[model samples]
Target chain A: MHTETPFKTHFNAEQAGLESLNIKSSNITFVSVSDMLALINQYGVEQLMLGMVEYLEADFKRWLDFDKSPRFAAHSAEGVIELMPVADHQQFSFKYVNGHPKNTKIGLQTVTAFGVLSDVASGYPLMLSEMTILTALRTAATSAMMAKYLAPKQSKTLAMIGCGAQSEFQILAFKAILGVTHVRLYDIEPNATKKCFNNLQSYSKENDLNIEICHSSEEVIKEADIITTCTADKRNATILKSDMVGEGVHINAIGGDCPGKTELDAALLNRSDVFVEYEPQTRIEGDIQQLPSDSKVTEMYQVILGEKSGRTHDAQLTIFDGVGFALEDYSALRFIFELIKQNKEAQQIELLASPEDPRNLFGLTQTHSTPSA
Target chain B: MHTETPFKTHFNAEQAGLESLNIKSSNITFVSVSDMLALINQYGVEQLMLGMVEYLEADFKRWLDFDKSPRFAAHSAEGVIELMPVADHQQFSFKYVNGHPKNTKIGLQTVTAFGVLSDVASGYPLMLSEMTILTALRTAATSAMMAKYLAPKQSKTLAMIGCGAQSEFQILAFKAILGVTHVRLYDIEPNATKKCFNNLQSYSKENDLNIEICHSSEEVIKEADIITTCTADKRNATILKSDMVGEGVHINAIGGDCPGKTELDAALLNRSDVFVEYEPQTRIEGDIQQLPSDSKVTEMYQVILGEKSGRTHDAQLTIFDGVGFALEDYSALRFIFELIKQNKEAQQIELLASPEDPRNLFGLTQTHSTPSA
Candidate 1:
């Protein structure tokens, strides 16, 4: 019942015999954190964000083509670690990510991640890359892409409610993708807002963006075309109150992604037309988790697919509950895979044994034996 | 509520300040296939198998402590790619493995895998290793460990039905751990049998084992003390019939793992008392899948834990429906992790970003920028 594709019909190796276990070409590309930064810097963050948006949009437009599921999460008192897996016909991708809110207090990351992309034909990993930086880049691109569909056409200002690790990326992505020129930043801690403002000073000048630090969420909540909430707090904090939000504004709610972790008040969700990444996952992990299970919410794919309308009226309040999904990570990893193919600095590692004789795996240990120190 | 341990309490780096993004200490150890083979060769296959047997037994004895689930599988037209994850309080491990029975025809392995072991406390990967060899080692160890309890006293002969890649490892492990000095090898493909025999020739001489090649399964079925069936056919092919079997023999069924795949006949399963790894998964994927949904079976853990008896009578037929589980991979990865810690040959890769100020992930990318090629 299965027809062989050209890639699967024949062996690409020079030694096309089962006994030739010498791996001339490795299937896995290992991109470290430094290498990933180099690759992204080579392309430039603005260009990378634009490219990611295209991939994200492409995947979302054909949402039915991908297998989607709520990530399997293992929760502890300290934090949560999750495995998010998704696959299409040709390839499969998964990310191992953790959200440890208390990590920063001990000089550790509140979030860190790595991912692998494998060919569905052979099940060998094509690439393994550090997803810490990639996740930040993709998360911003997803927000901006959603805002492009939901926000008003001439949206120029972004109210960044929490200016932390992800804030600068969000600001830059908005400027690059959505033509957002002004950003009003706010954080509970003044030092955090200051750090974000100082770090973005050169980028803001280079991109011709007006970046200002606001004293409070209310100070910028009413005056912005788009509001992005990305606070790192583990609790349900109302970063944006219902009464403070203005009409015709697009809310890019990025925080409150896990259960019992929310940024928007329940009343705010009730007041806005909610759109989500995936309904089942978003209902459990997004700000919509605070709302009723039967609540009406439009899937963002429906808008991208042109099946549902986004921001029907100029005065409408639109909310994209941006709980990051596996598809976005897949898009990011796929983008990295393409970016590093021509770049020689992308390291290759022999993650699987290719023996001359497939059955003589034990013989390799004898022949290729390295004296242990 | 959490007390800090010595490892978690202090920064072991010379640069203690958050501003020092320089990472002089790395937590990740990257053990490639060659390194894995070197390590295994250093420890000797028999000793490594013996060590894995201990780890496997310990893990199985405390099986209830593990968070177990049926592997998350992504099935395609060509094959299956699966992620098997397991975690206890201290460590978490998962393997990315693929099974394509037709891969050997194109000079590729039918099964190839890699895995990661991470610290549950920090949620960072501690070790990443090629598990193609490790899986073979672990599978053989687990079988031998089970045979230690299930096989008759002083069992000497192992009848290997299918001489595939894993056949040699099984023979060696049984010889080392269970003192099975005689092996009867049989395969429909004579080349496979030849390859297995040639690979075991030197090891057989060193270990004083009597290795003989058999033409058919029936030739050695009734004479052997332990019969191991590990054919590669994807469909149900009855390699062992009930009428051909003898009394008081232990059956190690490995190949009939996936759905619609069976090596032994249904009548044989009905006549034998089956023992399985993880009852829930075995019911769906093991040889028991051919039997009734509510068939009486014993869990391997129960036998190891003394909750259930193994080989009740002298004439009873004992079947071990061995559908590989995630815990075995965990044990193998853990064993590799300990073996490579003091070995300088084991390379370490920075698979994760360990910025001094964990919150300033964007800043690290900016400062550690590599010039674009």
Candidate 2:
């Protein structure tokens, strides 16, 4: 209802035609959190995850085509707010996300994000979306994509180390992308495990997945072919040790993203063949931030592009160090934009000004004649 | 209407109280182009200009409190899109703007802009607004603020070079701020001059001022006290030369923004004492881009802060290099946010998501029981 009709009744045909060609109508599609939820319901999570992974893989293959930059962060005492902007020749995308570990204590989300995709030609925003849910999906998809190349061929069971906000998403993505059937879940807090169990119990029954809630992380680690560590701690606490991680298992380490916040022991990271989304950003924010600056790591795009070897030996351990790059958000935005294009129910709101004569910008607001001194 | 009421019928008393404490209501005040126009119509331009100047001065005086960076720009064959971000401890702001000089040929705006202001604590956006009209007003206010300090105190008449989209705002700003009673306008295209003449003819009559449309820039340049050059060409243009400028005449060079886009001759710059906002950024985008890297320039903030002098002598030629900065947009956004706060009619839309339990983001969109592969 908020959208302005392209052809207004007041405009003459020539004026309407001219206005239609301008492409500066000052409106952008706005997808609220509820709208995104509705989209997921309509399309189904498996379908959305599968579609998102396809876009992510396609974008990652052409990594060099994108204008990539580390997120510009404004760190404060409480949290950090970042702007991650990336562009291709035709489109530009940016995500505004925050990381605040203590927000959960006060019943606020620890992480919340929103993003915009604009046309490069006019720099006019085409879509504005709630990215909190989308980020969870993309992060899970990125992990699954990495596991597809690096995990052992017969991998079927996943070890979910944290069982926090992103645990269900990771499980769902693995199921959709890798055909993963079994999941072993563990969390330091028993209530977190209960929440995860309550949320995904119906999912497990419907999908024919063997979901087990384990008593300890070690119990789950022994059975997992793929290990995903997504703890919410803000310190360098070792949730996985070098000895505990088995050979041939692919480790998806996501929770250890900020500097000084890592999940794996240094000894474990030193032993594994680590792959990263972007080396420059991962070195500073990923689990490898605990490693020495000169530590060797493989870029994930190279593996995807077939320039580097993946899972060379049956017993070799692989680690996917994901700090969440800007390009992944770009891919997610592109995916959602495509969906919105197909669905007319995606609501839009006016955000820009399109004056009939761009030169008469002030005339858009007619002025008062009394020039009071 | 897009805004979500925090207390839905489903919420219990405790949940409603908790939701009230957390300000993540998914609603953000949005000011559209039409809304901004209505605001101006209600408040009057002179009043808005005066208030904006006050906010601009207040922000400039405490310049060190802000985090400043050169705008991040993406250039193409046609034009450029830029992201300018700035923040303090409590709040963050960014502007997405594009400059496409050829756009007007196709009935599109040569420049379009929008911006966001968010709370730094939670990283939630507070407002989204159409910035094209706001930018025009703020640019004119900044020029007027500079002219008050740099121009001769007793100056009256004004000469406006290259009458375009921003010309009327500049004239009105001078009239409101400096009590300038006369304006002489010139442009390469006679139609542009005619448009300017028509727009301000009623304004001149209301304020009892002399308004002249000259055939050439020379006719206006000879008798003006303050000269403002605001051409829209995207190349190095000599709209004003050294011999044409007189003693004690203040020069407001605004059109010469962005690299390789300038209006004044290098010789004219060489003869005047140049003042700039943010030296490092001005070196790349302003008229001073033609000068040496180590060229002596006074920071406008220093002049505002009383750390440096302004307009030393009656015959001194002073130039205020008016390259728009992120902080000016910040000031503009702050001003608009205040007005919206006072008046609820300034419509806001839901741009973020708020759930009963922040951790259950996926729960917002309830998934189907059957997970089809």
Candidate 3:
């Protein structure tokens, strides 16, 4: 059902005549923002997130197979732009993401991202996708996935401390993944809380979820079984204090994802067991940056592999200091790539130049000249 | 005359009603392979290379202002994929490129690339372009730009070894930028040499340039004032020995760009005064990789900035061991971004998601719900 695009058509026409050469097409599948939303609409968001969590769990189980490195970041006065790349034996993926705390002040997203998935053998990109929405989905899915192993058993209350762009997704993921029945929302700006409460109205009604709006962090965390702190301040602000959090609570701290940005009080971290996605990256960008370099933390991959313990007792406080890892993006991209393959409406773009004769790249620019046989 | 696409239209309609918020559009300009070819056809290939050389030289002159790093590479048994990222104060650009020497056996190009350029202020991408063709152009422009500084006075003959995809572009860049009047070509495969010769026929005839084909590296290097080695072998087979290269000849060695790949003999690198684009990168990937790590080599930026000398005497052999740098890609991306801005046929793709209220990213996914302002 794919359209006859130039990149595919040219290569296919040449391939039909020269099947012995085993030519590969250079067309790249592109999933725009609209396309992503349509896919979410086609397959429910809950189903997509469940699929993504499966992929994330599967990838994390084989974590040793990946070639992982810390992201390459370019820091500026305004914000940071980063490239996060990871690879397995068969596929390679990378995400280009930017974070500017002041972007919302000017009516822009605080974070935006795009990514590519490629074949390892041919080294040609198989898919290029917009990751703004996908990133939100994956981040929330990751937090919820970790919560499956770290959150208190039979937990039903989720406290969302920052009602920003990521607030609703976090609530949905918890509700869908962990059977969360109640959401307590708080934000510094009342309008933000009102906006998030309004956005979740239909989802809460349809899913039998009870939602409450609170005025302060202390009020929000009163009966929260899981607390998610995602404030967008670029400094070390204590969104949660030592005495504010109770035992048997899980904290997913995601917003403090840069060098100088952090959220939890140091005393709070000292009193709790912390888990992170990738230790090397979390040390520099996660909420645990306030802690010493040798601070005790467990990597979630180890927990998933049954190599390490997770949430040992009912009274234990667990914090997931997630700065987001490249492997999650790889899983997300791979999941979406499979979804788009079955989607007849998927769009393909001519991102690479493929000539009939690979050696005759210059011949592509020659409109009037043909390749010499 | 841009089209009224969904991304631009939605953002623009929202932006007009909320101009006080200073909303920016999320549309990314896309230059497909057809667009790149059209651009080369619109502006002559020689002229584009000349313009690109000016940018390469200007960016190299202000080298310290840039944030430079070695490419992040993921190597496999067959090939490697790399991400080269570099940024200055105002803009950031990164190229995603792959090199697979065995790709041609299956009818794929040995190398293919694409890149993105973004604004540092907003951390939003401004353009996305197909860069397989662009990389070839920039590599040639960078080589010729360096030759302008190190080639001997009144240099005319350019002996090109390994006439593959990059051969004609190098010939054109040298002819346009350095005023080379004659070219001698040699390749291990006769068809490659024949293809390059046929490709350059019209340009050579129109530019008053004489071109000849030689069977051996030694025969091609005779009477040569500048030699460029761009063979595609991924091993340490020497394309040029010390005895083959004559005095007063500058060599632009570009093919040996990985750890195990070396095109020039060790004795040849030892005999020449090596100049490199970036010393740390070249020490691992360029022809200078064959030399000792402590071997003295001048960075081309220092020479361009007048901090060091270049081509001191007629008999001095100067080799520009170029592994290609991110700065050259940055300059080429910047140059093309400007060009596409003026070209009306430039395509725009929806590579980002933009909601009216930045904090209400979830509102974009909810098709039936209206924002409760």
Highest DockQ against the true fold, candidate: 1
lDDT of 2 by residue, A183-264 (tens): 9999998877777778888888987988988988789887688999999877888999898987888999999988888999
Q: Taking chain A by itself, what TM-score does each prediction score?
A: 0.92, 0.91, 0.92
State the lDDT of candidate 3 residue by residue for A327-349, as single tens digits: 99998998887777666657777
Candidate 2, residue A26: how far the Cα is off, in Å: 2.7
TM-score of the second chain for every model: 0.92, 0.92, 0.92
Q: What are the DockQ scores of the candidates, in order?
A: 0.46, 0.29, 0.40
Candidate 3 residue runs with Cα over 4 Å from true position: A1-23, A368-373, B1-23, B368-373
Highest-scoring model, lDDT: 3
lDDT of 1: 0.82
Q: Rank order by lDDT, top first?
A: 3, 1, 2
For B198-273, candidate 2 gives per-residue lDDT tens digits of 8888878988878998988789887788999999998998889888888888999999999999888888899999
The digit string of per-residue lDDT tens for model 1 on B333-367 reads 87777667657666777677777767777787677
* Model 2 stretches astray by more than 4 angstroms: A1-22, A367-373, B1-22, B367-373
RMSD of 3: 7.4
What is the per-residue lDDT of model 1 for residues A1-373, given as tens digits with 9 covering 90 to 100?
0112112112212221223222324447888877888866667677788887877887888799888889887776678778999998777999999898887887778788899987777767788898988999999999998998999878989999887778889988888888987899898889888888888888788768898888988886657999999998888888888988878999999997999899998998999999999999998899999998999899989999999999888999999999999999988887777667657666777788888777667777777566322
- Please give the interface root mean square deviation for model 3, in Å: 6.0
